[model samples]
Target: MNKKREIQSSVKDESLIEKRRAQMIRGAVTLFKQKGFHRTTTREIAKAAGFSIGTLYEYIRTKEDVLYLVCDSIYDEVHARLESLDIEKGSLEVLVTALEHYYGLIDDMQDEFVVMYQESKSLPKDALQYVLKKELEMVALFERLLTECRESGELKMTPKEIKLAAHHLFVQGQMWAFRRWALRDFTISEFIQTQTNFLLQGMAGEKISTQGAK
Candidate 1:
């Protein structure tokens, strides 16, 4: 998803660039959580990373580059953890477990999600498009699961319906973050249980009981 993010810098040492960027990203995430990307200055990010402004510029071109780095890192973490699940099983049970696992990850990284939602518009057009493309890949995971369900005759839905179902699954997972403040009384497990039930029943006649899906 972070393909070709060649952030131009005069630094020629690739290893040092990676190390410095990682430090910058960690520091930037903390700062972004406290003061949004819009409010943060390049000097502040440099100070947070324990570097001088000149050193910070060695890895990043501008403050927007750091924002892109932070967002890219978050998505990378999300994708890595999500890919660890038995997603290849392509069953309702697998999908349920994946959803529950993802909900947990989102809850754990709520601050990062909040920052991303509030500041992603600050990303450059190319960076925003890259992020959106990665998101589409995540939604496609659900589409694959639905296709397998259809093949197994566990659900009956048309291609267009399957496409919409994929989108629903992705958006619902995101809604947990987007609406979390308004739904503070709700737990991630409850969100997973209720939303999974809704999707399962809506897609098929049977409600998937993820109680045994753990």
Candidate 2:
């Protein structure tokens, strides 16, 4: 009975520890997003998390470790969302719609997403590389979608062109987050619709009606 009770108590302690760690990560993300990586301190994180500095250190070794934890958490959320998407549907329009949905999701996760986007370089070497690898995987997903669109004759671009196009689209999508100050007046759906229309029009090889196109 004594041994069984000890095991149960350990499990409960571990569970509480994880809960506290999660709280710290959440606080770190908010502070890092607001004040940047170099400016935010462990004391700020601890206070935000309602924990002591010693307690914060129990879960994370350094400020860099907290950055890694915050980045990894955001990456996990993005990866899970992308992985669950059904990419085999409808047409290029459908894919564009899905991309817009992803943009909206990121917008909703602004604090975490912004931290991951702007403070990635603050992570230690290995942690930075790990986060970058996940980012590359996300980019590859867009590349794969473009390749599919090309193979299905939904797009008229060559393989290299398709890759370049995907890169541009990804960059453009990121602008919604990175340039939110400039884009603050636009709704996510409006931005998505306008951007998708521009991309689709370009992909269709339609002639521009601009003054120089005469």
CA lDDT, every prediction? 0.82, 0.71
**Model 2, 24-132: lDDT tens per residue?**
7889888987788899999999999998988777766688877777777666666666665666543575466557656776787777777887888776677777777
User: After superposing candidate 1, which stretches have Cα over 4 Å from the reference?
Assistant: 9-19, 86-88
User: What are the root-mean-square deviations of the candidates from the true structure over C-alphas?
Assistant: 2.4, 8.2
Give the CA lDDT, 0 to 100, for residue 209 in model 2: 22
Clash totals for all models, in order?
0, 0
Q: Model 1 scores what on Cα lDDT?
A: 0.82
Candidate 2, superposed: residue stretches over 4 Å from native: 1-18, 88-90, 206-214
Candidate 1, run of 10 with poorest lDDT: 84-93
Candidate 1 per-residue lDDT, tens place, 75-154, comes to 78778767876655677777787777777778877767777778889999998999878778888878988888788778
Cα miss at 49, model 1 (Å)?
2.9
User: Can you list the residue pairs that collide in candidate 1?
Assistant: none
